[model samples]
Target chain A: MDSAGVLLDAQGLGRFVPGTQQWLLRDVSLAVRGGDRLAIVGPTGSGKTLLLRSLALLDPIDEGRVLWLSQTISARLVPAFRSQATYLHQRPALIEGTVEDNLRLPFTFRIHAHQDFDRRRVASMLEMVGRGADFLARSWHDLSGGEAQIVALVRALQLNPTVLLLDEPTASLDASTTQTIERLISHWHERTNGKRALIWVTHDRQQSTRVAQRVVQMNAGKLLEGT
Target chain B: MTVDGYIELKAWQVAIAASLVLLNAAISLGLQLGLGRSLVVASMRMVVQLLLIGYVLRWVFQSDSVLTVLALAVIMTIIAGVAAVRRTERRYPGVYWASSVSVLVSSWLVTSFGIAAVLQKADTWYEPQYAIPILGMILGNTLNGISLGLNRLEDELVVHRNLVEMSLTLGATSWEAARGPVRQAVRTGMIPMINSMMVTGIVSLPGMMTGQLLSGVSPLQAVKYQIVIMFLIASGTALGTVGVVLLSFRRLFNRNHQFQSGLLTAAGHK
Candidate 1:
């Protein structure tokens, strides 16, 4: 980690089952600097999801701590940290509403109230993936698997978090859809102009190498260097 | 013991009326309804509880102290809170306080307002006859509402935790993430009351009004009191159920706006 340029860091991070002396993740550490796309690959139950969620500060950590911009993120700052370091899950859970309603959800928060929902921005983002503004009016339940995930991506991008923790976001999608998602992400990344970073968790090695400049492996909760 | 126009039944007569449950228990044994033992035990408990309450109410009536009434009211609220929490079959930290607030705020407000302001029986405002039974009725109904609401809230929150985290990731607060479940819980909690309200006059007569009519009270007077009590129940339940749900949902998230799943003793169970 380049301490000065590091945007997010997890120092000797650990997680244990609620009861008993069992470690789900132990002594795992990671750092994502601005403009870095880090991809973590591992087998099922290898804790890639756990590590990504831990780094995102979504899961409760039993050991060590996370730092936003090298400053340790305490309980008080976790929400603020979460707002900046967002996590996107593989399965999208959209609320019961039109696509536009789902997109407008974040601004309803006190944290995001100052930022108005910009329809044109969202429409333009959709257009990048061959979707039009009419996509906004699509009902949540009626959305295809690819489209829902796309909307979810758009929703997360609208917040413009400094770091994104993508957990198998395209694992279930077709090749075309996966490429569209990747394009959308790199497009968003380019738009940020080296100010943002991303950590992708994928099982696909070639795709991981293609997406991330720095690829790592997580197995049974321990993070290891990729060959 | 004829204090007024109300006809009082003797202890033996009351015992005879209560003995009918023994026959029901026997029929349950014969028909194999699977609740024979439970029926007997529940009936015995009911008898014991009602008899104890009867004697306690006698004492309360004789004393006629507002402090005693208030103390009893507090006890009722505390029990209601505990009972509601228990019904969830899941433990939630600090939910008792939320439930107590809900019960006290709603039941107390409705009961006090009904007797003192609506009925204009300031002389017997806190009296045992006026207060205890009314309090009992409201507490029982609101207890059911709050418990149902709380259980639904917890269940919904747990089942939809992923969605909640999704919103949090999108820069939403804990409240904003859980907005849907909290509202659903409130609505789910008041469902029983709403259903009761819908069928009150047509399907079945309410217990309170029935008791009044059996005691030879005028139909008009009984209906007037019934209407007042029903309105009181509806409003109290709405306010109290909503209050408990909101507070309960608040506790599910901490100061940092993270969903505290540890608060749940069990999840995803009906």
Candidate 2:
């Protein structure tokens, strides 16, 4: 009953294509604690993204439920849960607008309507990734891949979620861009004073060693202790 | 000389029907469009359908029962809804109900306004002569608008699934996530109405206006009828497209506002 210590708890989660018997992920269990920077490394088709998606409650699970801060998340409470523990895909989904337009989007939701769109705050967050205030006004079409990822990260980070689920957020970017994302996420976690957490699904072994406080490996839908 | 509420086509002039068949035959033969069989079949079917519709309308006009008018309107709504649903690129379990409710509601609201509020020359608002034709035109336009919206709903979801999910992850409700695509569908659905209005009377005469003119109504009176009907159509289409798209998008999510993609038909078909 007292899972207050756990930020997120994924218990024996499973997923399968609905009309077929084959399971894409099964018997997967993981728990994220506050300030834990956990990295998940695995082969290309090893279900890392599937596992992260399930943990974020983005995908419907066939066999298990997710508990956010010891409270079981029912279907009715998913949006709230997702708001607190958000998932970022490998490729950021941007609309046809300026970066400021996208950043202001979250406040449009009724749940977040109490919050106002803080342009000054966004400008500072942009500064963390070496982008200026004018970066917020840049068109979505004009942003390079690195700039897009930074925008996506800022978009999620500005929400001030308690947990961040990163699905190879820098999978294809060069080293500098990867470093920017890593540093931005690290600073975000560090500032929480061990009150926030992150889980990154990555294929790069070296990046995992450098960024993750503790690393886990997955193979064929099963989670394994990192060798 | 009068024929079917008109004085232009004399009974002896019915021979023009034979001339149309020959002209179509010449078009099919000369262009090698292979349209001969289709043209013949379509013309014959048109003759039968129109003749039957004429008799039905005559009976409806003779009657004064509100129930009879409603029954006919309900039947037409069902047919129009089914046609709209069939126009979708992807087949889903809910498009039938979604489109039907949309077309019925929009058509009913607009038709009631036309018959009861605008075109109130009949003894009662339920008079079949006024009610039937007004409801028919509104229903026809509403059906097309909604069908186009339904098709766009399926297409946009498949194409923009990622962006939609991104919105969901940001704490947006289902309605918020789909607002973009639904608006796009509604606009796409309304394009035909907008295009027709843009060129009405300038480039071509509309069906109802032309019919009124040929029936010996003064040009000014016919133009007035066309104007009223055009506004009715615009209202019906705008309402129908919004209704159908909103209904279609609502089913795309669950009570939790989580996007359940299973509501969509399998991809690769669109």
Candidate 3:
């Protein structure tokens, strides 16, 4: 990894539920460079999701500092930092709207309204994800699980985020759909010129090996190996 | 019979009406027995609360003092707020206070405006009969609505938290992330009042109309009062529910826009 490619650096992070001594993610540290494809492998309830949430700045860390580009983006800037780093949920949460509406959702926000709204780009993105022109107008309920996941990924990609935190993006899909999605992700990475880094949280070891340039294994909230 | 004199009804008539009221209570009891613990608690609360309210109303109306009536209304607002917060999550500290203010302000506006300006032509108005019952109906509806809104919003925060997080990551503000669920919750919360509004006169005669008729008012006058009361109740509920939910959102989230665990109770706990 390039020295200047330290897009995300986290240290000494701990999160605890009140009235419980058990820390969800304790004493964890990780650094990722641009072009780094990192897979966070862990079993269920092993804090892989928690770590991803912390990295995405979706959850406030009890004790930690996350450095992004030589600046500490603390809890105060979590929302702003998170906006630049897409966090795709384990299950794609499709809103009650068409595929096009989902893709264009970010621009609806006042903070992101100034970003260029390109319909052609969205159509092309959807096409690359194995969707057709009619998909944009299709309601959310119409999409299968795999299709919904792809749409969600495309929506995140449309924001032109610097990093992607994927929580088992293909966990619920069939083998064929998973392979298709994998190809789409590869295509997206290439298209973005590798300016983006990915932190994929997954339980499938093979899937991790397939995408990870660097791998970290977590067990019960601690980074056990493969840093 | 003198027009201003209190006409004491025969013992049998009073007993029959009391029995009818008891019959309604027994029906409520049956519903409570069927639903189990929460409904039972709610029924018990309703019984105790109404009895207390009865005594309180008697005192206020007999005194006919503005201060006493206003004080009683304030108490009702406070209770409504407490109920809203408790129904959501008792662990959310400082939310109840804000809920109270919202409930008070919204209900006060509706009742005062409806009674003083719309119903009665009084310049400086404080009539316990009009104000107190209106206040009770408004507070009760708002209390139920606020409870629904708060409960739904909190559940959304817990269950669909990922969607909220996703929105935040997608550059949506805290309010923007919460807005969809809030709107859905508020809309859902208003449904009971909406249904009540829809079937006000058709399905059953509401209590206010029945009470007015018992008090020797004409059927037309009673109907008009019920209509006004229903409209005001719906208005109060919607306004108060919106106000409390919006205000409670501030307390539910931290400066970082993340929901604090303290505000959440474990599922199956409530």
Pick by DockQ: which candidate is best? 2
TM-score of chain B of 2: 0.91
- What level of docking quality does candidate 2 show? medium
**Worst ten in a row by lDDT for model 1 chain A:** A72-81
User: With candidate 2 superimposed using the best TM-score fit, by how many Å does residue B126's alpha carbon deviate from the native?
Assistant: 4.5
Off by over 4 Å in 2: A74-77, A116-124, B3-5, B8-15, B24-28, B58-68, B121-126, B266-270
* Per-candidate alpha-carbon RMSD to the true structure: 3.4, 3.0, 4.6
Interface RMSD of each: 1.8, 1.5, 2.1
Winner of 1 and 3 under DockQ = 1
Residue A176 displacement (Å), model 2: 2.8
Against the correct fold, how does model 1 do in TM-score?
0.86
Task: Give the range where candidate 3 chain B is weakest over 10 consecutive residues by summed lDDT.
Answer: B1-10
- The lDDT for every candidate, in the order shown, is 0.86, 0.86, 0.78
* Alpha carbon deviation, residue B261, candidate 2 (Å): 2.6
In model 2, pairs of residues that clash are: none
Q: Which 10-residue span in candidate 1 chain B carries the lowest summed lDDT? A: B261-270
Q: What is candidate 2's local distance difference test score?
A: 0.86
How large an RMSD does model 2 have? 3.0
